[model samples]
Structure formats: structure tokens, C-alpha cells
Target: MTYCVGLLLDVGLVLLSDTRTNAGLDNIATYRKMYTFEEPGERVIAIMTAGSLSVTQTTLSRLQDAIDIPDGPSIMTVDTMLEVAEMVGAMLSDVSGKIAGRMGEQASAARASMILAGQRRGGEPRLFLIYPEGNFIEATSDTPFLQIGEHKYGKPILDRVVTPETTLEDAKKAVLLSMDSTLRSNLSVGMPLDLCVIPSGEQRISERVRIDAEDETFQAMSVAWSNALRRGFQEIEI
Candidate 1:
């Protein structure tokens, strides 16, 4: 299990995902869950995945193969972000079904989901949460954020703070804090997070970062959030 979250704000899009993948207590390992494809001034797409590694990896490979074909209906060549979502959903569902079928009685282990966020030239930035069955819902003004994996532990902050008008800087802080909350509560999700930011209308990734476990800035921010939470909890009269 892992934790991945994306925020769709008026100014741009922010995405973050952990690097941990675990089969068991002794089988823990690190694998990047965020993948980005960009054509600089043309378009940018970022995918953050959670769930079965096999399903996600295979789906991405298939998508890449399609992209290699000139003028094909791949994510890059799609006319709109919606089309990109549809194409990804179809690929994910197909890969998931085939992998689960081969797993026989352990089909549940092959389940996977993804958060897709991007912008095409002349299009508004979009965010989507793609389900395991090839269907997805987009983030709207009412809900400007989407999350996957070990999401419950980190959802409260987003519910209280994220909105379509959020600034890009604040959005980044919000996502990192959300990830910090999950990291504390879940052992399956681990360090060295991948974070990406795409400013609206830029058609390119403005910021992409990898935060390690010992990163000073993240450490300080995490401590500050914990302290603030403790103070808030104590201030609430029982």
C-alpha cells in the first residue's frame, strides 16, 4: 500500500506520492509511484499510482508503447484531458482484468487505482481519480482535490483547507502536510516522496522534487504541523 494525493487549484496542479512498496514486514522496498510525461511547451501529464505494482507498471508500459506510435490515440496525442483520462482508464481496466484473471483465487491482490493530472496546450488543468474498473471522476470546484491509497489518515486537512482558489505555494504545503499525516499513521507508506507542480497555462512542469526521509525542510514542516495539531487539540474544550 502507498499514499498518493493531487490538488487542483485555480493557479495550477500539485501532486505527491510516496516511494514505498511492501509485500510483508520483511519484504519492504522502494519504488517510485509518480510518473510524468511532458512535451515542455506542448503538454504535461503526471500520474500518481497506488495498489498492485504489476497492474500499474503494465498499464504504464502499454501506454508508453502506444505513445511510441506516431499520431496514435495515446495520452500525448489525445485532444483533451478527458480523452487522456478515458484512454488511461481503459488501459488500466484491461490490464487489471487480465492480471486478476491469472491470479485465480487471489484476484483482489491485483486491484489498482491512479490519480491523473495534467494540462494540454489551450486547455485548463484537470485532475481525475481513475477507479479499478476503468471509470473515473474529475475534481470540480466543490472538491478540488483527489487522493488514493492510504488516504483516510490524510484527508482531513484537505477537506478543511483545499479549494479551487488555493495558491500554488499553499497547495504544495497542504499536500506535503497531508503526506506527513499518512506517513505517521501508516507503515506501508514510506519516505523519499515525489512531488510535482504544474503552473496553469505553462504546458510544462514548473517544479518536480524528491523529498528524502532526512530532508531538513520537510522535517521542520512536519514538526511544525504536529505541534500545531497538538495545540489545537488541547485548545478545544472538553
Candidate 2:
């Protein structure tokens, strides 16, 4: 299990994903669930995955293979952000279906999900949450964010504060605090996070940050959020 989120803003997009996968209590492992494809100055695509590692890995591997092939309809080669979302959804659905077919009774638990976000030159930025069945929903002004995996704990803050008009700086804080909330509540979502910011129409990543467990700035922010929440709870009458 893992936690991954993406935010769509007037400025661009912000994406974050934790790197933790576990088969059992004794079999935890770390693997990056975020992948990016770009032709700098032309287009950039980012993806965050959750659920069955096999399904997600195979889907991503196939996408990369397509990107490497000349004239293939990969994310980088897609005509629009909508096309990128469709291509990824189709690949994800196909991979999970085939793998689950071979797994027999465990098919139900072999499902996976992804958050696809990015932009192409001359196009507006876009974000999507794709299910194991290849279906996807886009982020809209009414819902400016998308999350996958262990998302419940982090959703409250976003619901209250995020808007299509949210400033990029505030959006960053909202997402990190959202992730912090999840990390505190879910052991399945562990550390070493990957975060990326892509400003609208830049056609390139503006910032890519990695926050490890020991990162002082993030630690400070987490502690601050916890304290603030505690204070608010204590001040409110039940």
C-alpha cells in the first residue's frame, strides 16, 4: 500500500507520492511509485501509482517501452493530456486484467490505481485518477485535487482549503500537510517522498523535491500541523 496525491492549480500542478510497498509485516520494501515522461520544453507527464505492485509496474514498464519506440502512442507522444490519460488507463486496465487472470481467486485484491498529471505545450495542465478497470475521472474547478491509495486521512484538509484559485505556495503546504496526516495515521504509507511542481505552460518540471524521513523542514511542518490541530481540538467545545 501507498499514498499518492496530485493537485491542479491555476499556476500548474503539484504531485506527491510515498515510496512504500509491503506484502506482509515482515516483507516491507521501498520502490518509487512516481514516474515522469517528458521532452523538455515540449511536454511533461507525471504518474503516481498505488495498489498491486505487479500491476502498476507492468503498466508503467509498458508505457516506457511505448515511449521508447518511434511513433508509439506513449504519454510523451500523445496528442493531448486527455490522450495521455486514456493511454495510461488502457494500459493499466489491460495489465491488471491479464495478471489477475493468472492469479485466479486473488484477482480481486490484485487491483491497482494511479493519478496522472501533466501538461503539453500549447495545452492546459490536467489531472486524472485512474482505476484498475481503465476508467478515469478528471480534476475540475469544483474538485482541484486527486488522490490514490490510503487517501482518507489526507482528504479533509484538501476539501476545506484547496480551490482552483489556490496559490502554488499554499497548495504545496496543503499537500504536504495532507501527506503528513496520512503518514501519522497509516503505517502502510511510509517515507522518502517524491514531490514535483510543474508551472503552467512551462513544459518542464519547475521543482522536484525528495523528502526523506529525517528531513528537518518536513519534520518541523508535521510537528507544527499536529500542534495546531491539537490546539484547535482543545479550544472547541464538544
Candidate 3:
């Protein structure tokens, strides 16, 4: 399994995902779950995936193939973020159906999911959680976020602290804490996290980071969060 989360704030969007894919105790391996497409100042899109490696990889590969076609509706040619999302969902659905049909039930159960987020030159930044079936739902002001795979453990922090008005910096912290929660609870989701930030109206990724096991900033943040949680528990009435 994998864990991928994205936050849609007033400022922009923030996304994070883990690389671990666990088949069994001895079959663990690492694979990238984040993919990006950008035209610099015109548009920028990021996709963070989870679930079955086969389905996700095939779907992504096919999407790339379509983009390579001369007249296809690739991410670069889309006029708006919503259109880009619709195109992705349609492509994912088509690829997943073929893979599932070929693999039959058990193998197809490993179907993947993805979180798509970004902006086009003339539109607002948007975020969507794409399901294994290829349908998707956007993040709205009321929810302000979306997540997939091993998401249960990390949802609490987001529920308590995240909102549409949260600053992009704070939004990033919320997602990191959310991922930290999942890491502690799910053995299948392991280290070396990928993070991406897209500031509103920039039409480009503002920040992206890969946090390894010994990354100092992530280590410090994790420790501080642990201590803070302990203190919060201590201060609460029994």
C-alpha cells in the first residue's frame, strides 16, 4: 500500500506521498508515486498515486503516450485545470478497465488511486482525488483537502487544523504531520517522502522536496510534533 495526501488552501496546493510498496514482509520495494507535468509559467500539474502498482503505472504510461501524440489533449494543451482532470480520469478509467479485465478479480483488486492537483495560466488552483474507477471529486472550501491509501491514520490532524484559509506554509506542515501519522501506524507505508507545493496563480511548482530518513528538517519537525502531542495530552482533562 501507499499513502498520498494533498491540501488545497487559499494560497495554492500542497501534495505528499510515500514511495514504499509492500507485497509481503520480504517483498518490499520503492517506487515513485509522484508525477508532474509543467509548462513553466503557463501550467503545472502534479499527480500522487497509491494502490496497485500495475494499474497506476500503466495508466500513467498511457497518459504520457497520449501527451506525446501530436493532436492529443495532453496536460499541456488543456485550457483549464478541470478539463485536465477530466482527461486524466477518462484515461485512467480506460486503462484500468483493460488491466482489470486481463488480470481478473484477484489481480485487479490491486487497482490504484491518485491525487491530481495544479493550475493553468488562467484559472484557480484545484485538487482532486481520483479513484480506482477513474471518477474523481474535487476539494472544496468545506473540505479543503483530499487523501488516498493508508489515509486513516493521518486524517485526524487534517480534520483538526486544516481549513481553506490556512497559509501554504501551515498547509505543508499539516500534510507532513498527516503523513507522519500514517508512517507510525502503517508498516506498509515507509520513508523517503515526496512533497510538492504550487503557489496560486504562479502556474508553476513553487517547492518540491524529497525527505529521506536522515533529512534534518523532517527529523526536527517529527520530534517537535511528537513532543507537542505529548504535551497536549498531558494538558487535557482526564
Candidate 4:
């Protein structure tokens, strides 16, 4: 399991994902769960995935193969972000079905889900949560965020703080603090984290940051958030 979150704000988009994947107690490992693609001045897309590694990896490989072909049904070739989400959802569903078929219907481990966030040259930026069956839900003004994997522990802050009016800088802090909360509570999710920002109308990624366990800034932020939480808890009336 892992944690991946994306925000579609009025200013731009923010994305974050953990790199941890584990099979069992002794099989812990780090694997990148975030992917980005861009044609500067044309468009940009970022994907954060959670669930079966095989399904996600194979689905991405197939998408990459399509991306290499001109005029293909790849994400880069899509005319709108909605089309891109449709293409991705179909690919994910196909790959998942194939894997689950091979492993028998009883194999629950073959499931996977992904969050897709991006913009096309002439369209509004969009965020989607693609489910295992080739369907997805888009982010709306009322709910400007989408999340996948181990989400419950970190959702509170987002529910309280995120909105269409959030600035890109504040959006970053919200996601980092959200991820920090998850990291402290869930053993399945870990870092280094992959974070990226795509400012509206830039048609490309403007900033990308990788935060590891040893990073001082992230450490300090985590400590600060922890202390704030403690103070808030103490302030509550009994």
C-alpha cells in the first residue's frame, strides 16, 4: 500500500506521493509511485498510483508505449484532460483484468487505483481518481482534491483547509502536512516523496521537489505540525 494525493486549486495543481511498497514484513521496499509527462508549452500530466505494483507498472508501460507513437491514443495525444482520464482508466482496467484473470478471481491483490491530474493546451486543468474498473471521478469546485491509498488518516486536514481558492504555496504545505500525518500513523507509507506543481497557463511543470527522510526542512515541518496538533488537542474543552 501507499499514499498519493492531488489538489486542483484555482491557481494550479499540486501532487504528492510516497515511494513505499511492501509485500510482507521482510519485503519492504521503495518504488516510485508518481509519474509525470509534459510537452512544454503544450500540456502536462502527472499520475499518482496506489495498489498492485504489477497492474500499475504494466499500465504505465503500455501508456508510455503509446506515447511514443504519433497520433496514438496516448495521454499526450488526447485533446482534453477528460479524454486523457478516459484513456488511462481504460488501460488500467484492461491491465487489471488481465492480471486478475491470470491469478484467478480470488486474487484480491490484483487491484489498483490511480489519481490523474493535468491540463491540455486549451482546456481547464482536471483531477481524476481512476478506479479498477476503468471509471473515474473528477474533482469539482466543492471538492478540489483526490486521494488514493491509506487516505483516511490525512483527509481531515484537507477537508478543513483545501478549497478552490487555495494558493499554490499554501496547497503545498497542506499536502506535506497531510502526508506527514499519514507517515506517522501508517507503516505502509514512507518517503522520499515526489511533489510537483504546475502553475496554470504555464502548460508545464513549474516546480518539482523530492523529500527524503533525512531532509531537514521536511523534518522541521513535521515537528512543527506535530507540536501544533498537540497544542490543539490540549486546547479542546473536556
- How many Å off is the CA of 32 in candidate 3? 0.7
lDDT of each: 0.95, 0.92, 0.88, 0.93
Q: Please give the lDDT score at residue 141 for candidate 1.
A: 93
Q: Give TM-scores for every candidate, taking all chains together and pairing residue i with residue i.
A: 0.97, 0.97, 0.96, 0.97
Candidate 2 lDDT over 1-238, as tens digits, reads 7999999999989999999999987899999999988778899999999999999999999999998899867788778989898999999999998988998898987799999999998899999999999999999988999999999999999999999899889988999999999998999899999999999989899889889999999999999988999999999997
Per-residue lDDT of candidate 4, residues 1-238 (tens digit): 7999999998999999999999886799999999999998899999999999999999999999999998777899878898899999999999999889889755688989999999888888889999999899999999999999999999999999999999998999999999999999998899999999998877899998889999999999999988998999999998
Give candidate 3's TM-score.
0.96
**lDDT measured at residue 47 in model 1 versus the true structure, 0 to 100:** 95
How many clashes show up in model 3?
A: 0
Tens digit per residue, CA lDDT, model 3, 123-236 = 889999888787899999999989998889999999999999999889889999999988999899989999999999898888888999898998899999999999999999
Candidate 1, residues 133-162, lDDT tens digits: the string is 989999999999999999999999999999
Model 1 lDDT-worst window of ten: 21-30
* lDDT, model 2: 0.92
